[model samples]
Target: MLSIERTLLRLVMAALLIGAVSVSGTVYFATLEEFNEALDAELKHVATSLARYRDLSDASSAQRPAGTGRVAEPELEDSEIETFTRDAAGKLLYASDEKVRMPFIDSEGLTRVSVGGESWIVYTARHRVGYAQAAQRVDSRRAIARESATRILPPMLLLAMGIGGLLIYGLRLGLRPLDAAARDVAGRSARSLAPIDCTRLPAEITPMVQAINGLMARLDDSMTAQRRFLADAAHELRSPITALRLQLQLLDRSSDGAANAAARADLQQGVDRAQRLVEQLLQVARTEPEAQIAPMLPLDLGSIVREVVEAASAKAEAWQLDLGATLAEEVPVLGDRSQLLILLNNLVENALRHTPSGGVIDVGAEMRDGRPVLFVLDTGPGIPKAERERVFDRFYRGGQPARSGRAALGSGLGLAIVKAIAGQHGAVVELLDRVGEPGLEVRVSFPRR
Candidate 1:
């Protein structure tokens, strides 16, 4: 629900508003201070001017008699400066207003005084004969300061509004690239796993776009692999189903009891081969996924080889093949237990299926060069050097495994499954011709812990 654009816009406006308020408040206070300073200076000037009249009165009294000359005053307006004079003996000599008397002080300086219950800024001057005081009402002086300071608000408000407009325009223009990137991503479909345009994108957004493109690329690959597996499974299963139908028809047409019995046995063999192929296909499907998600646990490769040999011993005996395992005490490996089990089972069964009667299939696991190694060797006609690599490819049963047996040669997924599981566990599988023997040795080497 949160929008980046809206949040940025709000923050920009909020800062602008706060700045405007702060500037306006500072201007208002500064203007008020200057206005009050001018008023105080005016009060001092008027009080100093009144000193000339007191000196004139002293001259007249000296020429004639004491307390004879009256101090002449200016005809001041009621809102203008109010004047008062007192002699050195604290006697009122003259007053500008008969009712509104300003308080007079002995010292000469600016002062604040309450006269007739109203505050005034009064300035007193010490003279040769008396003191002269000039005062102005505080409320009237403050009104002038407020009026002068308020003139700034209209222009400031207008400027603030204009800048806000510019801010909105700038924000819209700056965010256009982000909108374009969003649109580019929004237009894609499931079939289009192509990457986003990173060329013009901001540095902050480039990494996220790359991560999304990577995920989509992986998904596309997984889907493609699944499709290929389905196609291969359908192609391989069709042959067995058709053969089953043909075998059933032949068994129904046969009249002799012995011929019918033979047909039934062959049909059963076909069923077994189909069943094994389906099972191996399922294992192939399960193994070809991303291996990082698998629950790989530490296990002994020796134990895996021994367990697989024991399970396949009866099957090997039924086919007249000798099955056995030679294992070390501990050969540690990290791998999915079930998948590893399937991998070993496939290698052992592949040998059992291809090795002829009276042939020995030797399974072994041990540590070599600080790495765990599992190998299966059989005394059967081995794979050709050229075909060894291709044998591990899906659905590629090597060109007529030259062994005489009815244990079913293979559905071709055995070594392929083995290679896949080993690869998932970071192991390398090699199809090497047995030394001093006529057989193949499938050796799998796992990375050292």
Candidate 2:
């Protein structure tokens, strides 16, 4: 379908043509009318003059020739009038010898006359003298005027046609830029996010060009971010996998029972590290937009934190470390319950792993600024101020373990998982010092959606 602007232009041009044709037709018809009126008047004047000549000849009893010379000494007529006469009742009384063989005068005031073997209109009128009438030729006058008009019509029609064609051509030429712009956009591929070249465009299209450029820049940024994330994830996963393979090869040698048992334990530890890395990778992938995770619903943040604390306490007991929790009554937030639980579990477990056998781990929640604020505080070596932000990155482990006497085996992705889950739930994670002491405190806040 044509757009409204094109359709409107078409209608306007059509109306212009109609107006032009109508005006031309009216002027043409009016010219013909004026010619007829003048012809009629001239015919009446000729008839009146002829009638006066006839009355003079009748009263003098002398035959006066229609085209007689100035000398009046003749006793006989030389040339007779080439005219026709009719009575008041329109009965033909006489006609010239040239028209004798043809019809003379008609009662309807319309009749043909033959003069020198050519046709003419013999228009008649009654004279004031008794019973006598006169007529004159009106044909030659009307024919000349009509012939002049016929000669002028063709050029005027040609001019109108030329003007209309030029208008259509000019309109199409003016819209060429718009057509070119459309083709430029449609020819691009889905992965092509380059800016368009609009250096020669008209001023009206400047805004459109700017808009397309802005969108392209944003798409390029998103693509670059995704590429960086993939590269980092691959680097993190590769180290553990390579170590596990080497450990497995050593376990294959069973030279001595004690040596074999030690090798087996080392191999099992390597396998465990690899498994944890893979799980964290999957969790990060799931948090992405393309993962198709369902929308979050209202869930109790406090209860979820308590559950993670209880689980971490069991692990702490096995390691001879103390685990404790101080959850507020009910800290409700809008989020996926399972994802929130996963986040809580990772944070508590991370604290327990870094703390020594005699160190303490505490989990708690409180309401702050109408938001649910959950924190995991541990009596372990805290992150340095310069490296605190870097710790949230995937596979980033702190330089020193919080436990003074021992080290914890970790794949270094637990805090990374906590950050991802918090981000998905529209929350923020912050690192702080626990009560201005030597321990680290991780605080997560989920907005009340």
RMSD of every candidate to native, in Å, equals: 6.8, 11.7
Residue 326 error for model 1, in Å?
Answer: 1.9
Can you write out model 2's per-residue Cα lDDT over 230-279, one digit (the tens) per residue? Answer: 78778876877787778777778668999889889888877777787778
lDDT of 1 by residue, 296-374 (tens): 8998888888789889888888878888888767888898888888988998888877788899999999988998899
* Candidate 1, residue 279: lDDT: 97
lDDT of each: 0.79, 0.67
Q: Candidate 1: where are CA atoms >4 Å away?
A: 14-213, 290-294, 399-408, 433-438
lDDT of model 2 at position 307: 79
Best by TM-score: 1
* Number of colliding residue pairs in each model: 0, 1
Question: Given candidate 2, what's the lDDT at residue 389?
Answer: 87
